[model samples]
Target: MLQYLNPSSAYEALLEFLAAGGNVLVVIMFVAFFMWALIIERIIFWTTAKDGVIKRAKRAWAARTDHKSWYAHAIRDRLISEAKQETERFNGIIRALVAVTPLLGLLGTVTGMVEVFDIMAVTGSSNARLMAGGISKATIPTMAGLVVSLSGLIFINAFERFAKKAEHEVSDELLIE
Candidate 1:
């Protein structure tokens, strides 16, 4: 088992897995990497810089003496809007990436099936051994796509809640009074 844990061995295993999954799997891997990177960046922003944004908004709001004026309300709206924009950065891209992974996996399936059909036409036989490669190509990417999408869905939901809560909290803190 120690041999299995070797870095070279692990790298080889990864290459083998990618090869089995075919070209679509490679695309899925890259997309999942990007999606996770964005997710992690968002998490980092929320944990660290997010508070600073809220604090700045609160401080700006607190600085004003006119709490009931129309101009002051406009300023308040602007501050809230800025905060909302900052909070929602990259969310759309992350969501789009998440949504695309499954479709990519489906593309992989189609490509794999086409390969299998070509193999059948050339060989004039339905040999399991010959079709196994295409089958793996079809199935692995589908599984990978679903797995990536589900994981991303979980984070996306959490981030949505976090963003809403942060917006609400900011709104509450920036009182008109």
Candidate 2:
């Protein structure tokens, strides 16, 4: 429909797409931004988290401050998969964050559908113009949620791998004689 009106011009079509989608898609955009911020913050945070934790641990270990316990907790918080299962404890938080967003999107779908039904009951037809509002509200949120969830999950997992290397380095350096 948009393409026909824009006469096959991609830029025009895009403009039309955004213009048509402006109101409903705003929710998705907000969620995406939130997820993006979280992902970036975690990236920066975990980089710092793993940087000196284990090295500090090893020094503490060599100093006989019992570094393993503190190192282990730090590693666990970093979710370093290279370490023992103990180091991966924080994976739950990522799983929770990713999992919950999608369900929220699903909730948006349900609420949007309810509104659609209300519209339908009042108007009594499946007219494209009439139904488009509800459908857009329903689908847009889910797509947005999934995009945020999936992108965040991918970056977090990758960070986890990097953190594992740091954890291992600390652990190896700290091992007692």
Question: With candidate 1 superimposed using the best TM-score fit, by how many Å does residue 103's alpha carbon deviate from the native?
Answer: 0.2
For candidate 1, write residues 81-119 as lDDT tens digits. Answer: 999899989889888988999999999999999989988
lDDT of 1: 0.93
Reference-based lDDT, residue 52, model 2: 55
Total colliding residue pairs, candidate 2? 0
How many clashes in candidate 1?
Answer: 0
RMSD of each: 1.1, 6.9
TM-score of 2: 0.64
* Candidate 2 off by > 4 Å: 1-34, 46-49, 65-91
* Model 2 per-residue lDDT tens digits across residues 42-159: 6666656555555555554455554357665564334333333433444556656677778767877787787789889999976778878877778867776787689778976886
lDDT score, candidate 2, position 21: 42
**Clash pairs of candidate 1?**
none
